[model samples]
Target: MTEILLLNGEPLHTVTPQLLRATSYAHFSSLQVRDGKVDGLDLHFERLDRSTRELFGRSLEAAQIRAVLQAGLAHTDGNASFRLTVLDTDLLLRIEPPIAPSTTPVRLQPIQHQRALPHLKHTGTFDLIYFGRRAQEAGYDDAVFHTAAGEISEASIWNICFARGPEIVFPAAPILNGIRQQVLQRGLAAYETSPVLVSELASFDAAYLTNSIDPALPVAAIGEVTYAPHPESVRTIAAAYASQAAQPI
Candidate 1:
């Protein structure tokens, strides 16, 4: 499980202070590359393109991104966790060991916070990391962010969803539209996008978080409310995600 770093299409050997500072103004998307293919590959490209346009006043071509991803995969076994970051117009590809979906349910501590640019997956993650560490220090798995008015937005680095019977509810807040969430919503039979209040969490049958790495991770508890295990729901969600066709890079 060797890690490979590439800037543009060339190898990145060292990280100077200037390079580190330049990368702070970047936005990135991560995906698990299995067998040199990626599920929701188009969505990842769209995310990077949209973020680049909005953040840098320029568009990044999907073909260019695909080329960099392919270059990075060529150095690996074609199975790894890959991240494509846009530092202005430059592309930074990081390939690392693949991550499997979590089997254990996560416990989240609700925190009052919001990301600077909620729509884009930008590099300003100081609050996210800080709150996550505080939650871990307090014996929780991670932190779930909520607006000052108590509207649940998202978790530290994942999108949050709640289940009520056969319906999947996504909180209608200013948060990043995660690629996995978009794919799951498309495959789901019944789903809703609405404002979810933290106080109303107890009414839900189950809770879970989704990201590029973990598609459907059950939430055992959030704040003081606890949810019973819902393995069937998780299986259904995973099936929907797995049913998607993986496109070659």
Candidate 2:
């Protein structure tokens, strides 16, 4: 078992069978940790606050969580994945191993399944994972989900970004607004914040996915349909977030 987790500063739990099962999805947010710090921690906190209200019709107090974590966490390992969970009456925190992100851009097979509460990050996301794994299995690298409305969304784990010639677009709210999107917007790097279609994607120059974990990885190909990344733009934007993945929160 790949058991690696650091809670606060102590080794609280792991995915090991000897420990508890991973089957809960409350108002929560997962942080990308590298070395000894959390990436976009402020953003994660913001997301945790917003996601809690959006997902559970309640709000999570940052002060409370920070206090709990700072006082109880015990990190006894190296880099790991950390999750903060909050419920109506309870708050739980866990740390685990980092997820594997594709090193290169990925192709896509359109999956037109946009469910309710798409804007709110749902805990259960197997279909998304299945798409990614399937892409990798088929010798591709990623999967972009489309909808009757056109380009419904992309899964960047945190947020999805698409390139259409001179613009970097993202699906509007009701699809996914993840914290990363907010950050990108702050950087004034986001454009076309509206519903997108698969056909429109082809009309564009290129596309890629972004998140706390992966930051930015160009879209090498799109399904059986493939396109190349704009070397200059991809490099400049990617450079902005290259260090973010490992930046100290």
| Local distance difference test, candidate 1 | 0.89
- Per-residue alpha-carbon lDDT of model 2 for 88-198, expressed as tens digits? 445555656667666766666666666456765656677777777876777765566666666557653535666755567777635566555555655544456777766
Give the number of the best model, judged by TM-score.
1
Deviation in Å, model 1, residue 60 alpha carbon: 0.3
Across 45-144, the per-residue lDDT of candidate 1 in tens digits comes to: 8988888889889989999999999899888888999988898867888989999988799999999999998998988889899999999999999999
- Residue 15, candidate 1: how far off, in angstroms? 2.2
Best by lDDT: 1
Candidate 2 achieves a global lDDT of: 0.60
> Candidate 2 — worst ten consecutive residues by lDDT sum?
14-23
